[model samples]
Target: MSPTVHEIRNAIRAATGRFEREFEASFTKEELQAICEALKITVDGAGRPSTTRMRQQIRAQVGIAESLETADDSTFRKAELQAIADGIEASSDQ
Candidate 1:
């Protein structure tokens, strides 16, 4: 079954909480605010988290600007390929 709007909203909230916790450890408030702006998310005037529009905006931005048209089959394979390529080129003249 497809997720309801409430479910999606809850998921976003949970993910945002995790992000904020992680960011708090490594970033300043200003940096985190900038990231929020980039994501187009913000709290509404009512004090409730209101990221519905921002989530759509961010998704659209990514969909429109993504350079990768194809999906990566696996993250590990992609990392392995990158490491191999970098190693070969780096060792060529070293």
Candidate 2:
């Protein structure tokens, strides 16, 4: 199942810190793009955003510690990412 708007908000907040331990899942390409916007990180439309690009943007802007960062986009989870789009009413699809 997907997450609630509130949950996504919390997840977004958590992404700046200890993200991996916060959630377990992967955001879709669409959801990842939405997150970048929500976090005020502009994504160059060179192509569809990938996990690496988004993660780099998030890391660069948010400055999540590498020593503390985890391996995957499991930071906020796929559901939370979808909720970001839904909560903001930015996009219809995840």
Candidate 3:
């Protein structure tokens, strides 16, 4: 039987939550930008791109990065974590 719309939405939400936690923990700004480019996602705007924009673009391109194993932390860095946190905080302030 086909899944209900509610079931599909719930499944997507759960997957997105998992992706967000893993992506934030492992990806850097540069890495995200690269992924966006690879996915042909535009990360720029009339002015400089906002982190929120970049993040949305990256999230949309999560499938590209999803192949990587979450158990691998080799690409994770402290600076990237700080950047993600700062961007989130800055957006919240506005």
Candidate 4:
């Protein structure tokens, strides 16, 4: 089965927390743009994308990627994905 919306939201929250910790201060517009490119996500114009948008997009991309990988691995179940998401959320809460 596919991941539930709750699982996806939890994953995104966890990812946002990690991004916050990693950046500490903030990421430059250039750096955010670079990340967008590396993630194969398109930004509309030359103008910088908001940090919030970048974070959301990155989290979604990551979540999708993880889901796809899990789908391919027979041993990985829906409950496993939830557990992983829960773990990430728990770690970030610290």
- Alpha-carbon TM-score of each model against the true structure: 0.27, 0.43, 0.32, 0.38
- State the C-alpha lDDT per candidate: 0.33, 0.52, 0.40, 0.46
Worst 10 residues of 2 by lDDT: 16-25
lDDT tens digits by residue: candidate 4, 35-58:
556556787656776665665554
> How many residue pairs clash per model?
0, 0, 0, 0
Best by TM-score: 2
CA lDDT of 27 in candidate 3?
43
Candidate 3 per-residue lDDT over residues 5-50, each given as its tens digit: 3333233333333232322233445545544454467766685565
Between candidates 2 and 4, name the one with more favorable TM-score.
Answer: 2
Query: What is the TM-score of candidate 2?
Result: 0.43
The list of candidate 4 runs beyond 4 A from truth reads: 1-25, 64-94
Per-candidate alpha-carbon RMSD to the true structure: 15.3, 10.1, 14.6, 11.3
Q: Candidate 4, clashing residue pairs? A: none
| Best-matching candidate per lDDT | 2
